[model samples]
Target: MNDVYRIIVNHSQLISFWDFAEQPGQEAVAKGPFPYRLTEMAGPIERVEDGPFGAAAQVKLGQWWNLPRHACPELNFHGKDAKLTVLAWLKRENIPNRGCEAIAGIWNETEKKRQYCMFVNLNIWDSADQVCGHVSAVGGPTPGYKYCMTSAIGSTPIVKEEWHCVAFTYDGQYAKVYLDGVLDEREDFNPYLYDSGLFDGGDDGANFTVAAVHRSNEMGNFYTGAIGGLAVFKEALGEDELAELCKITV
Candidate 1:
């Protein structure tokens, strides 16, 4: 096993991990406990061999991966003390829309079932081309805003067509965004504070999605790029551990 995959699997709080090594006509299988599969949606995604983790999946506009909410119960993080982590290795690409790009999580703005999501260039608070960790306790837009404004945004813009490690962690009190395993500090944005906790979407929650999010009554905010790997943990990961993961190669 490679060091990257080994370290992720060894993490005690790991909920799911996907190396994006699946072949055509196969689902994106996940490792760790609750190893659910992500079915391709909208259209077929191309699998490329050149990747850091292993084979990578290239998702274009209108393409994404999906898993039903009922099947992945462990991913439904909620309550006042809810802690979570989401990590991804991606090669960014410029999309036609030039809007915010959604990486992963259970954020469905269409039905007001927003829990948590990892996004890039969120275009809020004067942010552009930066990693963003969005958290919502109300499962909807932040009060008095058209969209959720509570998020931890990194200062560094993720360059296009480069392999980068992006991650987010929420430890009940703060939401933090990491770029290439380092905390890309920003004034009051890198570690956004919100102590209210996550929202429990209950029986009618949004499905876990990758590369896109439901908004404006449809799936938008698509991330057009190559994804080498993705992982989720129930507990927030420390800086040292995330840095170690970023150091590993294929």
Candidate 2:
């Protein structure tokens, strides 16, 4: 596994939105004309269109929507000893309840049956001030493996409507969570818990996804808010690499 981590997308990667925009005679009527100004960011994200309110849709905290899982596609990182890092800028809405909800994570889907391989859920148990990070192994009739870690940040909470940087890094042996460039929590799991070819192996057809799950109900307790700057790294980033990522003002 390489120690160097790199940013895959930063708004500068978006290309043309014409391909994703509704055409003259398409199966579905256009929701609204494509907002050319929005695509000016980086690479075009499919299924996303300019909303009446603005560019990407803004979701309130604790409010969950299934919508089109494809809107935010999966990001794939390949390597056995790989360290995966997911970072995003977000603003939490001050909802009456802070129920547990997944901020974002990777998942697997086949038809209607959806399985969450890993995710973050907040305000579990309706506490309105608690959060938990969970990672699962396998899915099916057999009991799928699940491990969880909790933190107290949910209480004081970062300001409700400010840009907050949240990041999670998982090496083969441990998973670390960071808040605004600061180490917050860590969980060590049995590396053997994963079966051969589970993550990047060709058999499982593994892929990375962003922002929410394909099935709305799956996000049950957690999932509400606006998210941006979603970036994935193939390798575990060192302290310096993480600092650089946080320093990016754009």
Which candidate has the top score in lDDT?
1
- Model 2, residue 143: C-alpha shift (Å): 5.8
CA error at residue 5 for candidate 2, angstroms? 15
How many Å off is the CA of 77 in candidate 1?
0.8
Clashing pairs in 1: none
Which 10 residues in a row give candidate 2 its minimum summed lDDT?
A: 27-36
Leading candidate by TM-score: 1
Each model's C-alpha lDDT?
Answer: 0.89, 0.38
All candidates: TM-score = 0.97, 0.52
Candidate 1 displacement at residue 140 in angstroms: 1.4
lDDT score of model 2?
0.38
Instruction: Give the lDDT of residue 71 in candidate 2.
Output: 32
Show where candidate 2 strays beyond 4 Å. 1-57, 60-74, 77-80, 108-133, 140-156, 186-209, 214-222, 248-250
